[model samples]
Target: MPKIYTEKHLLLFLYNELAAEEVVEMNAELAKNPVLFEQYQHLKSGIAALDSLSEEPSQTSIDLVMEYAQKLAAAEVANV
Candidate 1:
């Protein structure tokens, strides 16, 4: 029986989480199914767009995280 690939499988393949065997199988399927190939292309482009728009946390956000970590460490020391 042939495997029926879903969007989740495609996402796993896109994110490099697919096993080597699965990668080969999915690639073959993509080649044979134009609709699957189109979906993959759309998802790939969406991921690229998201990557381009990604930004680092602001200084204030970094400082807040650091302060929280320090407070947590101090509380742990007190308990010890």
Candidate 2:
């Protein structure tokens, strides 16, 4: 019987989370199934785009965290 692959399986394969044997099986599936191959390509592109994103915190968030830390330190000093 042929193994059925889903989008989740494809994602795992794309992210290198699959076992070596599973990778081989998925590769074979991609080679024979044009639709699967296309889906893989689209997913690959989307992952690449997401990987390129920057996750820097905004200045306001940084300031708030710093203020919270200062309050914690002040409380600790008062308790000492």
lDDT, candidates in the order shown: 0.91, 0.92
Best candidate, TM-score: 2
Ten contiguous residues minimizing lDDT sum, candidate 1: 1-10
User: By TM-score, how accurate is candidate 2?
Assistant: 0.79
Write one digit per residue (lDDT tens) for candidate 1, span 8-55.
888899999988888999999999999999999999999999989968
- Candidate 1 stretches with Cα past 4 Å from truth are none
What TM-score would every model get versus the actual structure? Answer: 0.75, 0.79
TM-score of predicted model 1? 0.75
lDDT of 2 by residue, 8-66 (tens): 98999998999998999999999999998999999999999999999999999999999
